[model samples]
Target: MSLWALAWTLVFVATAMGLSMWRRLGLEKDMLIAAVRATVQLMAIGYVLKFVFRVDHAALTSAMVLLMSAVAADNASRRGQRLAGRFWRVWMAVMSTEIVTLGFLLASRVIPFQPAYVIPISGMIIGNAMVASALFLNRLRGEAQARRDEMMVLLTLGATPRQASRHVVKAAVKASMIPTIDSTKTMGLVQLPGMMTGQIIAGADPIQAVRYQLLIVFALIASAAFTTMVLGALTYGRLFNEYLQPVV
Candidate 1:
């Protein structure tokens, strides 16, 4: 698409701002800021990706993927700010997910180890894992607060912290994973994923696009599950103090 064509797409943003104003929702500023930031960020990434794809160096590609994973973990860790070592917990979960999913694809010879393929696929995996991590952390915080009494009772009954927080951790993990599971269930019928849609729009064959989309679908589900589970395991222990009483 041309610059003019891309500029015309701002109509949707204008429409959103207009609706916010009409409803007196007080979201016009936030909407406008988001729109501006999204435009600028996408343009910046587009250029960076162009350069990376041209260079196609292994070290640079690996650095780019690591940077993306780090950023994602940092963002997700905010949800667990009250927990100690939240950043590292999130980073480990995200990195593990990236390593496992991407490793499998590369080992199976499904996609080349080039920046053009790895970077984009890694972005999606990291993004999904980030969301899953954030969701799990947020839900775990809420569960800990809401179930403080129950956990305390369990603790008083001589249960370990892990056992006492088992229900809460399980609930949080399930809650975090539900969105990915539901989206996968309704995938093609409900919506064409962005990657698949973009590929088709770029004149790729529909079958090839679908194949790539399926690969992404599987990777995303695995990413969500692994990240949430790992994050839950790492985080649940922090809920208790040295005396084994509930702290979180």
Candidate 2:
């Protein structure tokens, strides 16, 4: 689409603002901010990606991936305000998830080690990991707070910190992963994924688009699961102190 066509998309944002005003939802300010922020961020990324694609250097590609991971970690860490060492915990989770998934894809030759493919795929993986980590942290904190008495009872019954918090951790991980798993299950039937839709729009074969989308879907599931599990394990320990008492 041309700039003119893209400019027309603001009508949707205007509609959202109008609705917010009509219903007295008090979201007009947020809606305007989000729209402007999205536009600026996307335009900036587009330019940055253009430069990266032109350079096509492995070092530059790796740096871009690291930058994305760091930013994602920062964003996810905000959701864990009550958790100790939130930034490092989320940074470790996102970095580990990206390394494992990207390493396997490169080593297996499933995707070539090029900026064009690596940057976009890594962005998707890192983004999904960020969301998963945030969800896990939020759910775990809520569950721990809601079930504090149950955890205390287990602690009084000679349960170790890990054992007492096991149920909450499991539930949080499962809750965090459900969205990714469910989305994958409904890919073709309910919705055409963005990757596949983009490929098709760019004139790629439909079948080939499906294959690439499938790879992404699978990668997202693995990334989400790994991130949630890692974050849950690292975080649950923080909820208890040396005396096996609930600190959160």
Candidate 3:
């Protein structure tokens, strides 16, 4: 946790870059860039979070959460370049999912509405939703391309665009959600999740940590499902043209 200890962590990044070079993988530059970006971004967020935690105002906390969600949506939207209006589609999906999940939790008093609790939990929710959105976009595009002929045939047979692409949409949503479901199933048995591990390391009770982890895991499942479903619905329509032909 000291500067000296943090500096030692760079050895891992150096080793990764060295391995990439030794293997002729042509990824040394990318590895270096990623390492530097991670360091700078984390340090910057650390300071910002320190300030937020100190101020602890509801308006500032809401603004921070909205900013995080916007950034996440932007990052995920890159994967859906083929889709029209990809950014707003992703932004709406992520924003709706975050609002519904966090709103419910806060209204129900399942979690406190303070910066210390809301900000971290919002990060996890928004982050997972971002990943889910990326996965949905990737799978949807791949499936649509692979099934282009079948989709065309269905359209020729007078099937509605939605009906023709139903299978692809469902499959993409399912594929996107599978990882979240699998990780939750294997939780403590496969890995100690970061939230729980951090709490335990910070001297919290194991039982308390377990409870918090469960809450997060459940929230994540909801987040993934909502993100995938909303994104799939929003994006599938964009894949068709005015003539009901597949465009993607």
The candidate that wins on TM-score is 1
Candidate 1, after superposition: displacement of residue 35 in Å? 2.5
Model 3: how far is 215 from its true place, Å?
0.4
> Model 1 residue 25 lDDT?
97
lDDT of prediction 3: 0.93
Tell me which of candidates 2 and 3 scores higher on lDDT: 3
* Model 1 Cα lDDT, one tens digit per residue, 1-248: 89999899999999999999999999999999998999899999999999999998999999999999999989999997789999999999999999999999999999999999999999999999999999999999999999999998999999988899999999999999999999999999999999999999999999999999999999999999999999888999999989998887
Question: Superposing all C-alpha atoms, what RMSD in Å does each candidate have to the true structure?
Answer: 1.7, 1.9, 2.0
The residue-by-residue lDDT of candidate 2 on 39-148, one tens digit each, is: 99999999999999999999999999989999998999998688889888998999899999989999999999999999999999999999999899889988898889
TM-score of 3: 0.91
The TM-scores of all predictions, comma-separated, are 0.93, 0.92, 0.91
> By TM-score, how accurate is candidate 1?
0.93
Better of 1 and 3 by TM-score: 1
Reference-based lDDT, each prediction: 0.95, 0.92, 0.93
Tens digits of lDDT, candidate 3, 140-230: 9999998899899999999988889999999999999999999999999999999999999999999999999999999999999999999
Cα lDDT of candidate 1 equals 0.95
lDDT: which candidate is best?
1
